[model samples]
Target: MLRQSFTEQGKRVLKIEQQALIELEQFIDQHFDHACQLMFNCVGRIIVIGMGKSGHIGNKIAATLASTGSPAFFVHPGEASHGDLGMITRDDVVMCISNSGETNEVLSIIPVLKRIGAKMISLTGNPDSTMAKLADVHVCIKVSKEACPLGLAPTASTTATLVMGDAMAVALLEARGFTADDFALSHPGGSLGKRLLLCLRDVMHSDDATPIIDQTQSIKDALIEMSAKGLGMTAVVNQQRQLVGLFTDGDLRRILEQRVDIHSTPISQVMTRSCTTADADMLAAEALNIMEVKRINGLIIVDKHNTPIGALNMQDLLKAGVL
Candidate 1:
């Protein structure tokens, strides 16, 4: 009995919410475009206000907008009545949310918001409600029905409101020509930021830590340098310091199985003539992709003349948190 009840309830909720989303599309009218254009033309930041469930969605929308190149912040309607109103400026745009457009706390501040000459955008279910009527631009998130079986919870209404907020943010994001680099600036502490900002030179081995051997050196000499550097590989460079080939522990083992004379055979004979390399200024994440695709563990960083300037291995990428 319990399982059947759950199945029925889940289906009902999904059906209601799906209908709500479909109804929301028609509400994206000229007012929605006006709201985006107002935000795009704002000389200052965006102040988002809401109460209850709408408040939660409003906070997230503000965060998304701020991270995507729109300067935005959320102020609770309750707090705005106290002293948060000081945070709103005449040059800013105010985005207010209330499902019924009649929440007392939100409605109480509409007059002051207008008095300050701030542009107002409303997200509500009722176009004729007081808050909507007072707004400069009203975006209707009206739904056909509530997802709650008892019609008390805010399931469908919240979903429509949230999707509308997302639509607005994305429209503004594209209209402003916001790029990934702009997003990285806002999320500097995240993995995306690290991938774009960190360069090979910032994470590569330097000084004696880099394993380098002359092309004329014997396989035994290359092995000694690789061991001392502890990178499992050595860059084979010419007398001019230009990288000519690479020798790894794997290469050494293959040559040894063939009974090649390690002490007398030149490293250039067994070394890979063509290996993947990166520039010193290349992003570490790009270097990681090259290494992953080539199935190689190390990369030599070279200058314009192909001279070995730096070197990094998979372990270095891991240590730098690029893995």
Candidate 2:
């Protein structure tokens, strides 16, 4: 059946890659440590180079290293032969990737790169190959078999190479003490950036924008403030400027059905006595969680005395990239 054939192929790929990973573990030696040390000690950026499929993997490794505080970038080996070799300097480190360890385009530029006095680290399947043998440090990435049944396509070999690249990037990441804040700085346009960079005070409404009422105020006054602010809610405070209760549109609708006189009824009798509030210094992402669990659309920002300092609704969170 077609399903059986597809399943068998999937299993074969996993098996081949799993074995490749096991083989890669044995390939890690003193040279791997030296490569890490060379990269760590370098004052300048790391320039990664490769050809064909190796180039794609090299590009990803360079991006990972750069984002994790390693200061790296990728360059095509073919382009290096054309004059891009000027990008490398004596203070820099070059990481080269090649399956055969004898890529013509890469090997052709080695002499010029070396003459520039740049340190070299080579990743290859053949430790005896010229590229690996000539480099200052060599990392072996040999695989026993290709995931392709034809044994011609670059399957398990490429996966092994990418995994080894990830291992090197992650090891350096831990050694450098890279934190989430560091990652956020590198990805300022991402969700993690918004969560880290945005604060409660940044998205909250201040001054007259917040709906507030005195504890002795009638329910009608509270409802008028809530409607004018359009936050669907208002905070009730005492004479000491401390929060007392909250009044929402939901409470108004329920009380309306009872035919209660809003003008005569005190807000304290109908308002939610125990209300949730957030601090101005908290992250906006944390505010979103409180809104989700409390199933409310608005929150009042309060000080230590529980006095309403600011306010925000779900729309505020949306505008601030918290949602």
Candidate 3:
């Protein structure tokens, strides 16, 4: 019975918040468009300010904007009253968030911000409140009710505020034509960045580490090279060091099934002639796509002249965090 009650309470809270988001959809009108245009045209960074819970949400919104090509940062309203207000400039745009549109700490900085000649955009539940009425633009984030059963804690209102903030950031992102490569620059340490920026040359085994064998070598010799390089495959090259074929673990299995003599059979007779390959300059993500489509476990990197220069397996990409 206790478990059932807890589950019911959770569902009720989600239902209320979901409805609040639906209502927020109606507020994305001309005013939202104007706010995005103001942010897009700002010469300096977008300075976001709020108090308490709104401050926490503002911080995330600022981070989102900064990562998506709009330069932005968050400022505590209380700090602005002391001396941080100097951070504002005539070229900057200030965005203030307050649930009631009357947070004392946030409201107190309005006159000083205006004095600095910064354009203001207010996000609040009440458009009639002092902060909303004074700002150059107001975005209404009004929710019909709190998800809190007692109607005291800010559950539904905060959810609505966060959704509205995401809408604003994404709108600005599309307006600026932000691309994945641009986003990768801001998140260089993450997996997405590695996938977008790392090329085969950055992770492939080159020089002596590449498993290269003469096409005339016996299958036993190819196995030795594969084992020494630990790549589960060996590139078969001609007398001039030009890649002619590839011998992999899959090929070894098929040859063994046919009872071929490993010690006497030349690799040229058993190696795959039309193996999939990638250039050293190709992106690791692109190589991964080729590997997936061709259903192969290893890939060889070749020079412009079709000479085998490097090699890599799925494990290499996994170790480099590009997989």
Q: Evaluated with TM-score, which candidate comes out highest?
A: 3
Per-residue lDDT tens digits for candidate 2, residues 14-124, read: 998998999899877788889999998989989999999999999999998999989999999878887888888999999999999999989988898889999999999
Better of 1 and 3 by TM-score: 3
Report clash pairs, candidate 2: none
Stretches of candidate 2 above 4 Å error?
249-261, 289-297, 303-306
- Kindly report which residue stretches of model 1 are placed more than 4 angstroms away from their true locations once superposed: 1-8
Please report, as a residue range, the 10-residue window in candidate 1 with the lowest summed lDDT. 187-196
Give the alpha carbon lDDT tens digit for every residue of 1-323 in model 1: 99999999999899989999988899888999999999999999999999999999999999989988889999999999999999999999999999999999999998998899999999999999998999999999988789887888999999999999999999999999999778878878978888777899999987778899999999999989988988899899999988999999789889979999999999999999988888999989899999999899999888899988778899999888788
lDDT of each: 0.91, 0.90, 0.94
Instruction: Supply candidate 1's per-residue lDDT for 31.
Output: 91
Question: lDDT per residue, candidate 3, 78-174, as tens digits?
Answer: 9988899888899999999999999999988898988889999999999899999999999999999999978888889988988998999999999
Best by lDDT: 3
Roughly what TM-score does model 1 have, to 2 decimal places? 0.94
List pairs with backbone clashes in candidate 3.
none
